[model samples]
Each structure stands twice: as structure tokens, then as C-alpha cells.
Target chain A: AQSVAQPEDQVNVAEGNPLTVKCTYSVSGNPYLFWYVQYPNRGLQFLLKYITGDNLVKGSYGFEAEFNKSQTSFHLKKPSALVSDSALYFCAVRDSVSGTYKYIFGTGTRLKVLA
Target chain B: EAEVAQSPRYKITEKSQAVAFWCDPISGHATLYWYRQILGQGPELLVQFQDESVVDDSQLPKDRFSAERLKGVDSTLKIQPAELGDSAMYLCASSLGLERINEQFFGPGTRLTVL
Candidate 1:
């Protein structure tokens, strides 16, 4: 079974401080990790994806994620938090080895950047 | 920027009523996906289409939910005799190719409320 875990229900960070949203996964084959962001009532926006090569991947809105294979983790990060960056973040994983295109997503983590 | 499009950004319906949502993928994107997202959770794939053909519908509730991409340019999802549990945000996304390695572009979702 392919599954993703976002342990934190909410993450609060002070403005201008770095932020991290944790994510971990379990899958049968190699994992393709992705991150997305959603604002109130809107659909998700793609952040970044880790298919191969670099362990650290950068994406939209000054966000990036690091794919750690041994740890089975892909954590979203930001160099500096902004109030506008506050939103719901989700982590998803696709198992290439399983030959399935469907992605399994974790329960979201709400990011609140204090102004 | 080209983006996926969806209709009826908000809908409120009574239980047992029928409802439908429409989506148009980004131009030149061959793969389309429909997802159901419950609040506080991640979006789950309901169906996937490659052009005019259905690639996957395993997660869709066949008893009531049905989806089609008649010409492969746009698609529609219909649900008959809706239940309270069916209330959720229906998101539509599209990607560039068949390999499923490309990042997906999402639309503003349709928010459904079943009474």
C-alpha cells in the first residue's frame, strides 16, 4: 500500500523565519514525491516534485522540498516565511514500481505565518 | 498562463439530488484527472483519462459516480442520488504526457455541499 503521512495538523511560524512542513511515506516501489498548496476554497497548486537525481528540489513561491529515501521522508521548506504563504500544504506520493499513476496524498498541514 | 478550468465554483444541493461538474484541461495536456477532497484531508483520485479513453476509474464509486471525457478536450463528472458523505471539493487536474512524470496543473475546484 502507498500512503503519505503529514504528522502536523498545523505549523505556526513567525514572519521572516524559516518554516518546515514534515511529510513521510510508505510505498512498495520507488516514490515520486510532490507538494501542493491550497488556499481557502481553491484547488491545489503544484509546488515541486522529486522523480530522480537531486535530493533537494525547488519550486514555486520560494518553496522547496528535500526527498530523503532512507528516511522515507519529503519535507517542504522555505527560507523565509511570509503571511501570504500561509495556506494548507499537502504531500503526495506516486509509486512508479507499482505501475500505477494514481497519487496517494496525506492529510494536510495548515501553515500559519504570523505577521 | 494556461490553466485547467472548472465550472460552478460552488454548489449546494439536497441529498438524493443529482449533480454534475465540468472541467477543461490545459491546452495540449493529454492526461486529465478528477479528484475528491474532503476538508482537512488530501485529494484522492476518482478517475483518470488519457485523451478520450479512460485509463483508470478504480477508485470511483461506480454505483453512483460516473465520468467521461467524450472528445478528450473536456470532461464531465456526474453523481446521482447524492449522499451527505459525497459533499466535498471536486478538483480537476491535467498533465503534459502519458508517462505521468510531468507535474499536474490544477483548476479552481468546485465546492459541493449536500444537505
Candidate 2:
């Protein structure tokens, strides 16, 4: 079975400051990790993904994530946060060896970019 | 700027009523997914379709919930005699399926309230 964990229920960051949202996962095989953001009353938007090769992956809206194999973690980071960045963030993982496209998602982390 | 489309942005229905949601994937997307998201939680996959065939429906409540991707283009999800617990957001996502690295594009989602 595959699963994801987002330890933080909420993260508050000042606008223009750095922001980080942590995520971890457990899977039977290699993992394909992804990050998504959702605004209130809207659907989720893809931020970035880590399949292979790169430990650091850049995404849209100036967001990026670092994949740590030893820690089984993929933490989302943004150098300069914006007010518009406040939203619900989710971390997801899929087992690369399972031959299944099913994605397991974390409970989610609420990010608040305070001005 | 092709995007997945979902119908009925909001729906409020009485308990025991029947409800349905629709989605249209991007022009060339080969994989479609339906997910249910409760408040303060990540989206959970209800079903997945590869083209017009069902790839996975193990998580779906087959007793009351049914889904289909008829022409490999559009899909529908139906819930009969909806219960109060059924109130949540229904999200539709699609992926190109051309490569394992393709990101899924999501719809705005339909917020359902079974009162």
C-alpha cells in the first residue's frame, strides 16, 4: 500500500518571504511525487512533480520542490511568497513499480501568505 | 490553453435525491479520473478511465455510485439516493497518458450539498 503524510495542518508565511510545506510518503516501490494547489471554491492546480533524475524540480507560479530519497520526503518551497499563493496544498505519490496509475494523496496543508 | 471541463459548479439537493456530474477531458487526453474531496482533506480517487474503458473503480461505492466514460472523451458520474455524507466536491482530472511524466489537468470541480 502507498500513502502520503503532510505533518503540518497549516503554515503561515509573510508575503515576499520564503515558504515551505513538508510532505512524506511510504510506498512499496519507487515513488512518483507531485504537488498541487487549490484555491477556495476552485479545483486543484498542478504545481510540480518528481519522477526521476532530478532531486530539485521547479514548477509554476515560482514554486519548486525538493525530493529526498533518504527521508522519503518531497517538500514544496517558494523563495518569495505572494498573497495569491495562499491556498490548500496537497502532496501525492504513485508507485512507479506497481504498474498502476493510482495516486495516493496526503491529508493536505493549508498555506496562509500573510501580507 | 486546453483544459478539462466539469458541469454544475454547485448543486444542492435533498437527501435521497439523485444527482449526477459531468466532465469533458482535454482534446487528446487518454486518461480521466473522478475524485471526491471532503473538507480539510485531499481528493480521493473514486474511479479512473483509460480512454473509454474503466481502469479502476475499486474505491467507488458501486451500490450507489456509478461512473462511465462513454466515448473516450466525456464522462459522467451518478449518485442515487444521495446521503448527507455525500456532500463534497467532485473533481475531474485528465492526463495525456503519452508518458508517465504527464501531469494531470484538473477541472474547477462541482460542489455538491446533499441536505
Candidate 3:
């Protein structure tokens, strides 16, 4: 079974400060990891993904994530926080061995960026 | 940018009532997905369609939930005899195809409130 875990239920950060939302995965083989953000009453928006390339991947809205193979972690990070970035974030993973395209998501982590 | 479209942004119904939601994926996309998102949780895939064929529906409650993508363009998800637990946000997303890393574009989602 492929599953993702977000250790924090919420993460608070001040404007202009760096922020990180932790995520880890459990899978039998290689994993495809992704991050998505959802605002209130809205659908989720794709952030970034790690398939098989560099450890650090850049995404839209000035956000990025670091993929750590040894840690089995893909933590989303931003150089500087913005009030508009406050939203619910999710971490997802897909197992390569199963040949399944289904993305198993974490519970979610509410990000509150303070101005 | 092209976006997935969904109908009935909000729906309120009583237990055992019938409800339906529609979705139109971005042009040229071949895969469509329906997800259920409960409050404080990430979206869970209810069904996935490759064109007009059902690719996955392992988590879908087959007894009450049914989905169709007749023409391979637009899709609809229907639920009969809805339960209180069915009160959730129904999200529709689309991807180009089944790849190692396919980005899924999301719709605004339909919020269902079962009374």
C-alpha cells in the first residue's frame, strides 16, 4: 500500500519568513510524490512533484519542495511566506510497483501565514 | 489557462435523497477523476476514468454512487440514497494520461450538504 503522512495538522509562519510543511511516504518501491494546495471552498491546485530527477524541484507561486530519498520525505518549502499562501496543503504519493495511478493523499496540513 | 468545469457549486439535500454533479475536463485531457473531500482531510479518489472507460473505482461506494463519461469529454457522478456522511466536497480533476508524473488539473468542486 502506498500512503503519505503529514506530521503537522497546521503550520504557522510570519510573512517574509521561510516556511516548511513536512511530508513522508510509505511505499514498497519507488514513489511519485506531489504537493497540492486548496483554499476554502475551492478545489486543490497543483504545486510541485518529484518523479525521478533532482532532489529540489521548483513549482508555481514561488514554492518548492525537497525530495529526500533516505528519509522518504518530500517537504514543501518556500523562501518567503506570503499571506496569500495561507491554505490547506496535501502530500500525495503513488507506488511504482503496483502500476497504479491512484494518488494516496495525506490528511492535510493547514498553513496559516501571518502578516 | 484551461480549467476543469463543474456544476452545482453547492447542493443541500436530506438523507436518502438523490443528487448529481457534472464535470467537464480541460480540452484534450484523456483522464478524469472524481474525489470526495471531507472537512479537514485531503481528497480521496472515488473513481478514475480513462476516456469513457472506468479505469478505477476501488474506493467508490458502488451501491449508491455511479459515474459516467459517455462521450469521453464530460462526466457526471450521481448518488442515490445519500447518507449524512456523504456531506462532503466532490472534486473533479483531469490529467493528460497515465504517466509517471501527471499533473491533475482540478475543478472548483461541488459542496454537498446532506441534512
Candidate 4:
């Protein structure tokens, strides 16, 4: 089974401060991790993904994520938080060895950038 | 850029009523997925289609939920006798293929409210 977890239900950060949303995963084989953001009444937007390259992957809206194989974690990060960045964040994983194409997602974390 | 499209941005219905949602994937995309997102949770996959063929539906509730992609272009998901727990957002996504590396494009979800 492949699963992801976002321990925090919500994260609050001051504007211009660095922010992080934690995510951890479990998979039977190598994992393909991804991050997505969703705004109010809108569909989820792709942020970034880690397949098999560098540990740090850059994404849209000045966001990035670090994939730690030893820790089984892929945490989304931003150098400077913006009010517009406040939204719901989700982490997803696909087990490449599982021979399935489906992705398992975490419960999601709500990010609030305070001005 | 081309994107996935969904219909009925919002729906309200009494318990035991039937409701349906539709999705149109981006041109040439061969994989489509339907997901249900409860409040404060990540989207959960309900069904997946690959070129009009059912690829996965392990998590879908067969008793009340049915999905079909007749022409490999558009798809429909119907829930009969919807329960209160069915109130949530129905999301549709598409990918170029079943490869794990392909990113899925999402459509604006349909918010269903079961009264």
C-alpha cells in the first residue's frame, strides 16, 4: 500500500517569513511524489513532483519541496510567504513498483499567510 | 494551454435523490480520473479510465456510484440515492497516459450538497 500523511491540519506563517508544510509517505517501492494547491471553490493546481532526480524540486508560484529518501518525507517550502499563497496543500505519492497508476493523497494541510 | 472541464459547479439535492457530474478531458489525453474530496481532506480517487476503458475503481462504491466514459473523450459519474455523507466536491482530472511521470490536469470541481 502507498499512503501519504500531513500531520498538521493548518499552518500559520507571517508574510515574508519562510514556510513549510510537512508530508511523509510510505510505499512498497520507489515513490513518485507530488504537491498540489487548491484555492476556494477551485480545482487543485499542480505545484511540483519528484520522480528520480535531485532531492530539491522547484515548482510554480515560487514554491519548492525537498524529498528525503531516508526520512520518507517530501515537505513543501517557500522562501517568503505571501497572502496569496494561503490555500489547501496536498501531498500525493505513487508506488512505482506497485504496478498501479493510481496516486494516494494525504489528508491535506491548510496554509494561512498572515499579513 | 488545454485543460480538463467539468459541469455543474454546484448542486443541492435531498437525500435519496440521484445526481450526476460530467467531465471532459483535454484533447488527446488518454487517462481520466474521478475523485471525491470531503471537507478538509485530500481528494480520493473513485474511478479511473483509460481510453474509454475502466482502469481502476477499487475505491468506488458500486452500490450507489457508477462512472462511464463512452467515447473516450467525456465521462459521467452518477450517484443514486445520495446520502448525507455524499455531500462533498467531485473532481475530475486527466493525464496523457497511465505513466507515473505524467502530471494530471484537474478541472474545477462540482460541489454537491446532500440535504
Candidate 5:
């Protein structure tokens, strides 16, 4: 079975400071990882994904994530946090070996950017 | 900027009542998914469809919840005898295909409140 874990329930960072949201996963084979952000009363928007590429992947809204195979982690990051970036972040994973399209998602991490 | 569309942005119903949500995926999308998101949690897959055929529904509560994407382009999910636990945001997503790296596009989700 494949699973994802978001260790933090919430993260607080000052605006203009670097921000990081942690995520880790367990899968039977190579993993396809994704990050999504959901704002209040809105649908989740895709941030970025890591299938088979460079360790660091950049995404929408200046967000990026680094896929660390040794750590089994794909942590979301932003060079400079913005108030607008405050939202719920989710990490999802799909096992390529399973040949199934289902994605397992973590509980989520709430990010708050303080002014 | 084609995106998934969902109906009944908000719904309120008494316990034991039946409620349904609808989704219209982007044109040409071959895969659609239904997910349930409880407060403060990431969305969980309830069902997945590939070209009007159910590809995965293991997480769906078949006893009380049902989903159908008869025409393949649009889908519906129904819950009978709604329980308080069913009150949450129901999200719909669609993707191009079952490719391991395909990105899913999400809809604005329908918030259901069981009273």
C-alpha cells in the first residue's frame, strides 16, 4: 500500500521569509509526487509534481519542491512567503509500480504567513 | 484555462435526507475523480472513472454512497441517508488520462452540510 504523511499540522512564517512545508511518503515502487494548495472556499490548485526529473521542481506561484529519494520526502518550499500563499497544502503520491491511477494524500498542513 | 466544474456550491440537508453533487470535467478529459475532504484534512479519493467506466472505487462507501459517470464527460455522486459525518467538501477532478504523470485539474468543490 502507498501512503503519505504531513508531519506538521500548521506552519507559521513571516512574510518575505522562506517557507517550508514537510511531506514524506511510503510506496512499493517509484513514486509520482504532487503538491496542491487550497484557498478558502476554493478548489485545490496544482503546485508542482515530481515524476522523473531533477531533484528540485519549481511550480506555480513561485513555489517549489525538492524530491529527496533517500529521505523519502517531497517538501514544499517558497523563497519568499507571501500573505496570499497562506493556505492548506497537500502532498499526494501514486505508485508507478502498481499500475493504478489512485493517489494517496496526506492529512494536510496549514500554512500561515504573518505580515 | 479549461477547468472542472461542479454544481451546488453549497448544500444543507437534514440527516437521513438524500443529496447529490454533480461534476463536469474539462472537454476531452478521459479520467474523472470524486474526492471527499473533511475539515482540516486532505481530500480522499472516493471514486475514479475512465471514459465512463469505473477504474477505482475501493474507498467509496457503496452501501450509502454511489457515483456514476455515465456519459464519461460528466458525473454524479449521491449519498442516501446522509449522516453528520458526511458533512464535508466534495471535490471533483479530471485528468487527460491514466498516465503516471498526468496532472489532475480540480473543480471549486461543493460544500455539504448535514444538519
Candidate 6:
């Protein structure tokens, strides 16, 4: 089974401070990892994806992710946080082994960027 | 930016009543998906469509939930006899369905509140 885990239910950080949201995964084969952000009353927006690239991948809104295969982790990070960055973050893994192209998402972590 | 469209941004209904949500995916996207997102949780895949055919629906509660994308352009998800547990956000997404690019584009989502 392919699954992702986001251990934190909420993470608070002050504006201009660096932020990190933890994510780990379990997969039978090579994992396709992705990060998504959801604002209140809105759908999720894709942040970044890690397939088979340089471990560090940059994404929209100055966000990035570091893919660590040995640790089975793909953590989302930002150099500096902004009040508008507050939202729900999710980590997902694509189950290609099942040949269904289905995404298995984590429980989600609410990010509160305080100004 | 071509964005997906969803109707009835908010819906409130009593239990046992029928409710339906609609989605229009981005133009030229071949794959579509429906997801249910509960508060404080990540979105769960309910159904996926490749054109007008159903590709996967293992997680869907077929006893009361149904989805269709007859023309492959727009889709609809219907829940009969809605239950309090059914209160959630219905999210629709679409992808190019190509092997290399699997990132999905999502709609704003429909929020349902079942009393």
C-alpha cells in the first residue's frame, strides 16, 4: 500500500521566519510525491512534485521540497513565511504500482503563519 | 490560467435529502477525478474518469454516491439520502493523463453541510 504521513496537525510560525512541514511516505515501488495547499473554503492547489529529479525541487509561491529517498521523506519548505501562506498542507503519493494513477494523501497539516 | 469550475459553492441540506455537485475541468484535460475532503483532513479520491469511462471508484460509497462524466467535459456527483457524515467538500480535478505530467488542476470545490 502507498501512504503518506503528516505527523503535525498544526504548525505555527512567525512571518519572515523559515518554515518546514514534515512528510513521510511508504510505497512498494518508486514514489511520486507531491505537495498541495488549500485555503479556507477553497480547493487544493498544487505546490510541487518530486518524481525523479534533483532532491531539491522548487515550486510556486517560493515554496520548495526536499526529497530524501533514504529517509522516505519529502518535506515542504519555505525560506520565509508570510501571513498569506497560512493554509492546510497535504502530502500525497501516487500509486503507480497499482496502475490506477491514484493519489494517497496524508491527514494534512494546518500551517498558521503569524504576522 | 485555465481553472476548473464548480457550482453551488455552499449547500446546506437536511439528512435524507438528495444533493448533487458539479464540476467542469480545464479545457483539453483528458482525466478527471472527484474527491471528498472532510474538515481538518486531506482530500480522498472518490472516483476517477478517463474520458467518459470510469477508471477507478473503489473508495466511493456506491450505496448512496454516484458520479458521471457523460461528455467527458463536465462531471456531476450525486448523493442520495445524504447523511450527517456526508458533510464535506467535494473537489474535482483534471489532468492531461500523460505519463510524464501527472499534476492535477483542481476546481474551487463545493462545500456541503448535512444536518
Model 6 spans with C-alpha error above 4 angstroms: none
lDDT tens per residue, model 2, A1-115:
7889999999999999999999999988678899999999988899999988889999999999999999999999999999999999999987555555777789999999999
Q: Which lDDT tens digits does candidate 2 get at residues B1-115?
A: 9888999999999999999999999998998999999988999999989899887888999999999988899999999989999999999999987346677899999999999
Write out the backbone clash pairs for model 5.
none
Q: Provide interface RMSD per model, one decimal.
A: 1.2, 1.4, 0.9, 0.7, 0.8, 1.2
- Give me the displacement of residue B48 in model 4, in angstroms: 0.6
Clashing pairs in 6: none
Instruction: Compose the digit string of candidate 6's lDDT tens values, residues B38-89.
Output: 8888899999998898989999999999999999889999999899999999
Q: What are the runs in model 3 whose C-alpha is more than 4 Å off?
A: none
User: For model 4, how does the per-residue alpha-carbon lDDT over B18-79 read when each residue is reduced to its tens digit?
Assistant: 99999999999999999999988899999999999998899999999999999999999999
RMSD to the native, candidate 3? Answer: 1.0
Instruction: List residue ranges in candidate 2 displaced over 4 A.
Output: none
TM-score of chain A of each: 0.96, 0.95, 0.96, 0.96, 0.96, 0.98
In model 4, pairs of residues that clash are none
lDDT, residue A56, candidate 2: 96
Please give the DockQ score of every candidate, comma-separated.
0.77, 0.74, 0.82, 0.85, 0.85, 0.77
Note the clash tally of each candidate: 0, 0, 0, 0, 0, 0
At residue B37, give the lDDT of candidate 5: 94
Candidate 3 TM-score, true structure as reference? 0.97
TM-score of chain B of each: 0.98, 0.97, 0.97, 0.97, 0.97, 0.96
- Global local distance difference test of model 4: 0.93
Give lDDT tens digits, candidate 5, residues B1-115.
Answer: 7889999999999999999999999999998999999988889899999998998898999999999988788999999989999999999999888974777899999999999
Docking class of 4: high
Candidate 6 per-residue C-alpha lDDT over A20-59 given as tens digits, one digit per residue, 9 for 90 to 100: 9999999998889999999888888999999896999999
- Stretches of model 5 off by over 4 angstroms after superposition: none
Query: TM-score: which is higher, 1 or 5?
Result: 5
Candidate achieving higher lDDT, 1 or 6: 6
Q: Is candidate 3 or candidate 5 better by lDDT?
A: 3
